[model samples]
Structures are given as C-alpha cells and as structure tokens.
Target: LPRRGADTPSLAAKRGKIARFYLAHASRANNWDLVDLSAPYIIGRWLLYPDADGKLPDRGILDTLASHSDLWHQRIGIVATLALIRQGQTADTLRIATRLLDHRHDLIHKATGWMLREVGKKDPGCLLEYLESHFRDMPRTALRYAIERLPEPQRLYWLKRQ
Candidate 1:
C-alpha cells in the first residue's frame, strides 16, 4: 500500500526509500489511475537520473514491464515513460509502442496510442514518419487515438491507405 497522506517527506533518504518502495510494489499496483499516478514519479524519475558510471538507467525496465504476466504491470511500463516524454525523450516510448503492437487489451492499445499521439503533439513529422512506416499494422483504435489531432486530409490519407 502506498502512503496516501498530504505529509511530504522533506529528507532525501525518505524520498529515496519511498521511490524504492514503489518500484518493489509495482506488481501489486492495480488499476489505470494507480499506475498513471505512481509510475512517472518512481520509474520515470529513476530512469531520468544517470548512475555512478554516468550511464543512464536501462530503459529495459519498460520492456520488462511490457512482458509481465500482469496487464496492469504492462500499462505501468508504458505509462511510466510519461516522465521521459515530458523531458522530451521519445525513443523509449517508441520502443515500448513497438513491443506492445500485438497487445490485445484495449487499455494497452489506448495507452500505446496515447503515447504516440503525444509524440505527434511534440513532433508531428516524427509521428508522420512512424505512421507512414507502421500504421498499416497498428490497431484501429490505436490509430484513431494517435491521429485524433491531425488535420482531416492527412488523417483521411492514413485511414484510407491500402
């Protein structure tokens, strides 16, 4: 169970401990809102910080979550990358999206496509490039979500693509 109070820990050690606790308990993290609220702070922030070797955290964390037996964990994997996306980092999102391409869950599809739509918001060209290359195989719900903000003509072009 996560701490649900308004009391903010002022010590670095406490915050670190809390973050670690979140990571350890992620498998038990059920529900979309729970994941959406917690993942960015724990997994996302952890990945943003480089380690002793000056090497960035392994984004394979997302991949691990993507492969979890739990569907909630899978959502955590993708949603956690939201922190990275906020910092203008997108590769992990794209990589995770590719891995979840065949995911059967509507929640997974929505989450993946939401991230891609976010990518489009940041760099439409990049989204266009991705869509051009992979839209054919993208699930319709995901495709619709990803292109929700695109201009009508371009959106139509992609939709009608053979």
Candidate 2:
C-alpha cells in the first residue's frame, strides 16, 4: 500500500512519511513474498540514507525487528539488510545476522544466511571470520547458505566442523 512520488519538495520528507506509514501497518505484511518485495525498498532504503536534515538515520529499528516476537517482523528485520549489503555496508547485516542466528524459524534462518551470503559476495573476509567464529553453533541451513560461494575445501571444512 506504499505510495510513490510525493509532490512535496523535500524528497526525504516524503519518503520518510511513507516509510513510517509502512512500519505502522507492517503487521499487514502477512506473507514472506510481501515482506521480501517491500522491506528492502522501503525500510532498508529509508534507513540506509541520511534524512532531509542530513543526519544519519538511527538503525535501532533493525534490532527491534530482529528481536521482536513476531515471525514476520523478524523476517523483515533480517531481510531489510539486503539493501545495505547491496551497497557494501555489511555491518548492519552482520549485526542482525548475529541477532537472528539462533532463531527457531526456518524462514529467519534462510533470510539471515541469505544476507550473509550476500555479505560474502561483497566482502569475503568478513563472512569467513563470522563463519569461523560461529559455524559450530549456527544452524545448518544458515551455514550452508553462507558458505555456498566458498571454495569446495573451505565449504567442506565449515560443514565438517558442525
């Protein structure tokens, strides 16, 4: 239900309002497809850039979504980091991945691993270190996804460590 192209002069302000509205009604984003389609473009884009006043946006919302009890919200939180990963900003993605690493839901595990795989694409060292530190404890689905692009020996090593 998010609208596009505000006539208002302040582009940031227009997008800000729309992003806020999206969060207010985020519960309606009932399905994974709805979330994957929208969170990156709206929440991710909104937080990635500075505001109209030019201050860095607070990223606490990412933590909030990651820690929330709602499954879809948690999925949104991890998936939203896709935008940041695309821009080579993997810090937020890693942080959220850590938060959701032990999540019980298969979907959250998939999202976290998918985002980490993206981080690997952008920065392989970061992803390797993260795997080295947590491979033993991380979920198999996530481990498989994160190491999908690594060389065969490295992938086998991480998988064997589990």
Q: Judging by TM-score against the true structure, name the best candidate.
A: 2
Q: Write the per-residue lDDT of candidate 2 for residues 1-162, one digit (tens) a residue.
A: 124653333767777887889889889998889999999999998886666777656889999988888899898898998988898898899889998878898888888888999999999999999998888778999999999999999999988899
- Best candidate per lDDT, number? 2
In candidate 2, list every pair of residues with a backbone clash: none
lDDT of each: 0.81, 0.86
What is the C-alpha lDDT profile of model 1 across 19-65, one tens digit per residue? 56876898778888888888878888767765445456678879999
User: What's every prediction's RMSD, in angstroms?
Assistant: 5.0, 3.3
Pairs that collide in candidate 1 are none
Error of 1 at 124 (Å): 1.2
Residue 59 local lDDT, model 1: 83
Native-to-model Cα distance after best TM-score fit, residue 112 in candidate 2, in Å: 0.5
> Each model's TM-score?
0.83, 0.91
